[model samples]
Target chain A: MKTTRRTTILLALVLLALPLAAFAASPSDAGTRWLHVRVVDRSDDGESVRVNLPLDLIASILPEIDIEPHIKDGRVTLAPEQGVQLGDLRAVWAQLRQAADGEYVRVEAGDGNVVVRKAGTLLEIDVQDGPEGAEKVRVRAPLAVLDALFSAPEGEIDLAAAITALAEAGIEDLVQVEDGESSVRIWIDDRPEAP
Target chain B: MPRPRVTLAAVLVATLLLTAGGVVVLAAAEVWRAGTFVLSVRDEGPNGARVAVVVPGIVATLAAVAIPFMLPDEAAARIRPAAPAMRALASELAGLPDAVYVAVEAPGERVLIASRGGVLVIEVDDGPDHVRLAIPLHAARRVLRSVAFAAQRTR
Candidate 1:
């Protein structure tokens, strides 16, 4: 009887272990790691722009900018988490139009840097990373232009005030723009951590 | 199968058709019932343009009716290509413990590997081959919950 009981226990253990052994032989044992992404855009004027960044960096910035990711059919799609009403955009546009004083403004990013230019006015802003962990922002424009853009009547531009205005206009709190002499520059050390 | 003569005839006919404003529609009627419908115009000067519409609908319909006869032929067989994502999932599953069960759905095929206990269903996108497997946030949350529950049960 003891021998039979021992044999039964051994048989039960073997049955339980057989599935475990089969699972151990699966191919997806090691998890995935790095991801690479590349994007290229060409304009009719023969100007081309290319951007290459890691997927992890994009995921880190999504939450900060209020973007959501949807995973379906082995792909992840990104979209704005909150929809912006037309009224909000109209309000911001009205504010910007008043500040522009009938000038055209254009913003572009390429080669790890952002550039903002205001036509008919000496307004140019360049944003990039600094030597340290701090972000570097350089602005070269007229004091009057900066003051008008920031809605500062005293001819003085405050970064905090400008950012507050933008926030009120429905912009996310991703970065704060600072005002400098003859320009505005904002620095923030909010780089996302690498996985 | 008729080489030189057929090729010369095809070229001459194509040139003649182009000059006469006649369009020659080449259609794989086996795939679509409508097939290639050609609408040609022959300008006769004072007589205006004579419009002639040639539709291969009848031929396509006949071919569709004869699909049963064509099925036995090896040439008519549909070939299903294996999806790369399914292959990757299979490779990954091969190294896991025997308790794991995996169900991988590819473009036109479904592969199931059930072993012991845990079940994992992977749905592959019909998108480009470069796209890797993406686990939905809800699914991941469910897995986390299960793991937490198991850990708590053990405790």
Candidate 2:
């Protein structure tokens, strides 16, 4: 009985110490996640191309960010904002074709806004900040976009050429074309698209 | 004998678990600035036989964190594949041909691209903002021959 009791006490002590031991054993954040983006292709009209993004993968790309979900057919649907819209796609492309350095474009969709930097690929879209009735939750695109863009045939089409093309496609005034290497942005006003 | 084997296996498992835990703690210490350090000294017998032990347990831990910044990177020209799976999927998503690219070890990821044309096989290991691409085996052979020729000329 005494031996059993001693063994029981020892086991209990070990159980209690398990967490501390484990804590002492491992470090935190051994693995890390990073944001990625890529381009798929040029649209049929050389306008905007469809991008493939997985919601979970996209969500993991950004650290310390929250995204909202929507209810559809009694199921949850995550909405990720793709910066492209009809009007910005039209005007930005034309201006981009002739835009000099230090120019930017701004695009507004409903209450949401997206800014494009000159000659850069990333479209910084703002989903928050809207009126009480506006749908301004939060969203992010997938890192797969980066994967595709970087892997594409980078032979003749340099990063600047791609950003210029995106601008000339009427992306928006808020959208800026940025320098590929220098990371300088060109800002523009958000203009209303023609109906 | 059976009990001894079981005990040995348990000890081995315990050692492995401890090693893995130590690795994780070290990695966490890198990103979060949190870690536990232990130092001990022991003296035994009449003359005081001394011993010292440090907790980090691995020499590589210090070097892995330090070397990246200290050395200058030599810019060598090379063409390499980057993000084969993402590239394949993006191509398919953008109306390119559908292909399958396997993740090899990470089966949990649902997205993959593969092709069977036997013309060019590409593999992409994707990371945040960076990717590693591997060329097809046939291409590797051709590249190897060219590298051999270059080495011969240098020699």
- Top candidate on lDDT is 1
Error of 1 at A74 (Å): 27
How many residue pairs collide in each prediction? Answer: 23, 55
Off by over 4 Å in 2: A1-54, A62-195, B1-63, B71-155
- The prediction achieving the highest DockQ against the true structure is 1
TM-score of each: 0.18, 0.18
C-alpha positional error of residue A194 in candidate 2 after TM-score superposition, expressed in Å: 48
State the DockQ of every prediction: 0.02, 0.01
True contacts kept of each: 0.04, 0.00
**lDDT by residue for model 1 (A1-195), tens:** 566556555555565555445435533422222222111122232211112222232233222231123332222232334453434443554565466543344444443456665534334555664333145455545434234334422222233333333223321122233222122212212221121
lDDT, candidate 1, equals: 0.34
In angstroms, how far off is B2's CA in candidate 2? Answer: 33
